[model samples]
Target: MEIILVVSFSYLSGSIPFGLILTKFFGGQDIRKIGSGNIGATNVLRTGNKFLAALTLVLDILKGYIPVIISLQYFPELIQLSCLLAFLGHVFPVW
Candidate 1:
């Protein structure tokens, strides 16, 4: 149960589309329609808002990093699963 909870948390955290949210909130444009049409920081940069892009990058990194750190501290045996789920969540987010 704890493993499931941790993995779910990790995936959900990674699935947050920070670039899309930040760009839309700050730039008033859908990031998906921007340059590369990607939801990552690289595409956020295309919006010409360096601060938003950097912030998105940091948030994205933190989403992944925080989960791994939690797994390391609370469930070291789940580190690999946590990392994989986080990546998958980012690549295939529910949102």
Candidate 2:
């Protein structure tokens, strides 16, 4: 039950598409159709905002890292699964 909740939350959080939204909001560009066609930070960089790109990268990584870390703190055995779930969220995001 807890594992399901944790993975679901991680997926939802990671699928935020921050890089794409921020780039469009600030630079008025669709980051997804540019560069690697990815909604990640590197694609955000193509939008011409170095600061925003860096921030997005850090935030994205944190999105994955934080969940694993939190899960580890509570249930050490779940650390690996948590990290994998986070990665999946970023790869196949809902948003």
Candidate 3:
């Protein structure tokens, strides 16, 4: 049950779509409608907002990193599953 909860949290966190949220919050054009139509930092960079791009990159990294770190500290046996789920969540986000 604990592992289930942790993995679920990791997946949800990774699926946040930071690039899309940042672009929209900063009053920029929809990131998905521009360059490559990806909701990643590279696409965010195409929006001509370096700061937002960098921020998106950092946030995206954190989303993945934090989950693994949590698993490491509290659920070491789940580290691998946590990492995979995080990546999958980012690639196939719920949102």
On residues 9-83, what C-alpha lDDT tens digit does candidate 1 reach at each position? 999998999999998888789999989899999998877889998999999999999999999999999899999
Residues 1-95 of candidate 3 have per-residue lDDT tens digits of 97888879889988999998998889657889999999899998887889999999999999999998988999998899999999999989999
Error of 2 at 74 (Å): 1.3
Whole-model lDDT values for every prediction? 0.92, 0.81, 0.91
Off by over 4 Å in 1: none
Highest-scoring model, lDDT = 1
Number of clashing pairs, model 3?
Answer: 0
The residue pairs found clashing in candidate 3 are none
Sort by lDDT, top down from the best: 1, 3, 2
My TM-score estimates for the predictions, one after another, are 0.95, 0.85, 0.95
Task: After the best TM-score superposition of candidate 3, give how far the Cα of residue 36 lies from its true spot, in angstroms.
Answer: 1.5
Q: What are the runs in model 2 whose C-alpha is more than 4 Å off? A: none
Candidate 2, 1-95: lDDT as tens digits? 87887788777776778887778888788887788988778777776779999989888888887788788888777777788778888888876
> Which is the winner by lDDT between candidate 1 and candidate 3?
1
